[model samples]
Target chain A: MHEAAARNGITARFGLDFPSFALDVDLVLPARGVTAIFGPSGSGKTTVLRCVAGLERATTGFLAYDGQVWQDEARRVFVPTHRRPIGVVFQEASLFQHLSVMGNLKYGMTRAGLSPEQAGLDAIVALLGIEHLLARGTKTLSGGERQRIAIARALLRRPRLLLMDEPLAALDLKRKSEILPYLERLHDELDIPILYVSHAPEEVARLADHLVLMDGGKVIAQGPLSETMGRLDLASRFADDVSVVLPVTIGAHDDDDLTRLDFASGAIVVGRRPEPVGRKLRCRIRARDVSLSLGNHADMSIVNILPATVTALGETPVPGHILVETALSGGERLVARITKRSSTQLGIRPGVPVYAQVKAVALFGE
Target chain B: MLTGDDVQAILLTLRLAATTVALLLLIGTPIAWWLARTKSRLKGPVGALVALPLVLPPTVIGFYMLVAMGPWGPIGKLSSALGLGTLPFTFTGIVIASVVYSMPFVVQPIQNAFEAMGNRPLEVAATLGANPVSAFFTVALPLARPGFVTATILGFAHTVGEFGVVLMVGGNIPGKTRLISVQIYDHVEAMEYANAHWLAGGMLVFSFLVLLALYSRRKDRVDA
Candidate 1:
């Protein structure tokens, strides 16, 4: 497993100390797809991203990207941020106020020794949907437009890795929604690994394939998104926002204003989605929306019920509540938060058979 | 109408101001950049030293400069060792003194501009593959342009209007050190009120126009 990871992964070990806070993290993240560094505010998510970009020098650090050491404090090998093949998008749009949109896009390209055509500047502009905004001055742009341009500028540098520090945090909800599609496009079309720092769980569920949960400058958990998010022990850290992300495909659209989503387990139905059949989507199922029953009730109003066995149970921060981990027949996992009394009443224990009724699913596009 | 002597003084003053502004900018940029970004304990002492010219009388600076450039002084000794002779009472002497006298005018504005820019642009530039020197020229320098404008204008205007420093360091060479302010003093002492009026009034109008242009441009930037 270690050999496989070393062949195609980023191995980062950083220890940084500040007066009020300290960051110590050792992460081995996959080289492809988006990996989210997630936690509540002040969990040192941004610090980890900064260390990877060489923006913050860790006191004791070892960082290697795909077997090439970018920083090794022991060997006295350190590549400065400019020398590293990485692009960064700060929280704010941070566009150069002195340059036009086109100028900003070309700013990194010229420095990277790549011509406009060579950097695929036109394709990137079209990818971010900023072609019409090329000649506009940065000051005249809206929040969403500026962020789009910033992303395009980062891409124009032809980076091997992209570090995004809450790129959507500074924008209002309206602007965030406006820019999310472009971000989704980048994830689909680009092959670069993205280290995204976000405190927003919804954004993580919608975008991330792997999850690294951090708290108080330490890694609490890290794994594939579904397995990590479904962990019973880490449920309380999510507080009232406990949920799991499932990779599902559009199986079919029923005539009765509903659509079926197929996962590794049996399919579940949601309200009719506009996406075509066979298109993949990520759906976040909040643990609070799931309920457990001792027997499958065919007469219930809930239509998406599947046979599951209780895997584990853990206490939540909420009074008298327990988070129950269950594995469906086909091995997909789900977490259902239930009252302690209800768990006892339903005989919900490890190895107990039960049915999981999913009350809601929030679909995120592929 | 201006006399030939008056024209010579005016030309000399312009030349001194131009030379002083150029020298101050070259020397002040690094100082201002350091003041803006450094966390060293020496920042306080260094900043106070730079601003000393703004508070102290110009004659105090001129007196020290005069002594330092005298034949017996250290700078004079170095100059002689280099076979360049003494510097006092020469155009070069007055130009050096003017640079010291106007140092604050050039450095403070640029420092303020760099501080206001924060570290975001430079960090962004670095992540975009610009080295430190490249970042400064491409990012820091261009963003601090308004400060440069302010510094150039203030440095030029302050150097042109200087009196005590020029009088102490350069004495009154005919076509070299006798600037407009000294010429105006000369006219008044000689009871040539008409001549003083022509030059001094010109100085007044010119200073006002320069300030007006600067402030209006600043207002435009603020509004934008």
Candidate 2:
């Protein structure tokens, strides 16, 4: 019945109030690249992922990706999970407990009408760094290793898109770090699109080319990571910004223990970007930690900036400053707020400009 | 010292247990898998049919098998056409009846194991590239090892203890299917208490040991 969605975008008619679980997500983002869906607990991130995978039915909606339409009430198109060209990596890394690490990956590839020879077993093994784990039993694997194998196994199906529901959520810090590179590499190396669900803003910032923010089953904000989280009114709308993630290309490493993170227009001076040369990193900025700046301060080296295009300008109930946004030419985006008095003195308006200097540590931690 | 009849019954019972267990395994595995996975409307009826012998009298199963395998039934017709003659009152007939009567013992554990495994592993297999059938083979079967063992042993032990079914289907044909259970009953009825005691005691020990072995091994596997 998902044939309708196979034709175009998924349109959920359920609106923002889901009667059953009270979750309402409405977004028809391009089904290519990584569209990360983030939310707090009970925010329905997994449910949305499940919906796209066709695991669970949406009360009312139409989902379409690429050229394939998955669900549509108007057309009555619905595709069963097996018939869908999608792969899912569950939060539990549900490896076939009966099979070896190698066998688990091979299981789905074998069914996808691709023989071991055709699927290139070694490529996946190498990509997930599971060569040594091939013969090992699934029961013996560490949480991170299991998830890597789970991802590898899902990939072998040659699916058009991948669905990962916090695949790294079960891992410890060390394992999460260890597996992050592979995930990053996977996004770059594969041609297929991915829809990742996570509560970790760090993952969204670093991995998502597009972000769909969810709260209480609704799409609160969506678009590129910086643009979406860069909304000034976002913090006041919610108690505090859950996470503010930004993607930046490395510019250079400064001698003063700060790395030059080249954004869209200006460079940010974060302590370090943990990647090799030319690697992209998702650095986080917490709203609670950020403050407004009118211009570059000579005495301070606290290095992030907002060239301050006023994406939004208004009085906040907190009786502080007006929130502002500035889009950089580099395609990178930032957010800042100056006091209402500062806005008046600096003559900031919807299109007026200013600077948003960031503190050394903002909402950037895991 | 026991007579030649006692020894003959012992050998016959062993042969029956071994044959029944092997046949049950071959026949029960596929049936259990089907019962475990299929959601057909007939599943309830078919499952009950498989379990019928466990609760019903053994003589009923033996009588049905005898009728189905007699010179008048299709199987009997086919056997005679092939020059195999009548099936009733033969070792083969006894074996078939035992397989039917002990079916639930073999199938239930296997079905439970399959049910417990759930669809997760199979789905995982499908996503990995295995088609449905291969996934069942590669992922489902291996995990049900302990259940298979339990079914086989229980079926074999139950078959060894059968008296009524063997009597109805195969009769007390010496050196053929005059099983130990019938022999023990015969001795007791004839007031041959000592001989009955010997055979009954042996059977009790054998069954206890089989159960002990099955459970101990199962516990170890599970614990491991």
Best by DockQ: 1
State how far residue B125 of model 1 sits from its true place (Å).
Answer: 0.9
> Per-residue alpha-carbon lDDT of model 1 for A1-366, expressed as tens digits?
433455677999999999999999989999999999999889999999999999999999988899888898988889999999998999998999888888899999998999989999989999999989998989889999999999999999999999999999999999999999888888899999999999988888888899999999999999998788778788877777788888899999999999999998899999999999999998899899999998878899999998999999887898989999998888888899999999888888899999999999889876
DockQ measured for candidate 1: 0.88
List-wise, what DockQ does each model earn?
0.88, 0.37
| Model 2 stretches with alpha carbons more than 4 Å out | A1-31, A40-86, A108-123, A213-222, A231-244, A272-279, A293-310, A313-333, A336-354, A361-366, B38-97, B165-171, B175-177
> What docking class should model 2 receive?
acceptable
lDDT string, candidate 2, A213-326, tens digits: 887878888887666655665655433453356655678877777677765567677675555446666667655455655566768766565555555553444556555555
Q: What lDDT does the true structure give each of the candidates?
A: 0.92, 0.76
Listed in order, each prediction's TM-score against the native is: 0.97, 0.79
Q: Count the backbone clashes (under 3 Å) in each candidate.
A: 0, 37
Worst 10 residues of 1 chain B by lDDT: B75-84
